[model samples]
Target: ALQHYHKPSIFNSDQGAQFTANAFTGTLKQAEVKISMDGRGRCYDNIFIERLWRSIKYELIYLKAFDDGNHLSQEVSTWFRWYNRQRPHQSLNNRTPDEIYYESCL
Candidate 1:
């Protein structure tokens, strides 16, 4: 990740001493990247990931019980493919993510 992407202007994370440690903050400081933190005990810090977990629980994970870790992994992979390539999101103007992404690439 460090090699492939340009340094971001700001990084957001929940409060953790490890993140606040000099080693970590020093790197961001050297890079001139701003660090943003969530308020303690606030639930909104991980809203997007939380929303995705909600969707997976309601739409896929709760539908059937998996016999093993491999089965669960496979099903999650399939669900992601269906999510990105097939399902239309109303917020995206009823287009699948792949459609919007690939259109821009071409």
Candidate 2:
């Protein structure tokens, strides 16, 4: 989806090991996508993703303790659904990410 809907021009991510790995970079390059990486140790350069991680951990991960990978996956999926639908975000003008994104498209 995102290509079918938003069709973003660029994709950006932090210079983490995962993003730097050949597997990840190769896939993006194959898609003819331009990749932008944050400078090392520059937290502010990736503030949006950092804030998203903080919300995910604090609102979901920190509150739950799972027994196994399956359990964690289920709970995380549920939490992500709720986060995108129900949770209001300050940066989004009190709207959930889904709401803001779809509304902008309209």
For all the candidates, what are their Cα RMSDs to the real structure?
A: 4.3, 2.2
Mind sharing the TM-score for model 2? 0.85
**Model 2, residue 106: what's the lDDT?**
85
TM-score of 1: 0.61
Model 2 off-target regions past 4 Å? 1-7
lDDT of 1 by residue, 29-102 (tens): 88899998788877588686567779889999999999999999999999999999999988789999899988
What is the C-alpha lDDT profile of model 2 across 1-106, one tens digit per residue? 4456554567788888998999888877777778998899898999988988998899889998899999999998998899899998887789898988788888
Looking at model 1, how many pairs of residues clash? Answer: 0
Please, what is the whole-model Cα lDDT of each candidate in the order they appear? 0.86, 0.85
Residue 88 of model 1 has an lDDT of: 94
3 in model 1: Cα distance from truth in Å? 8.8
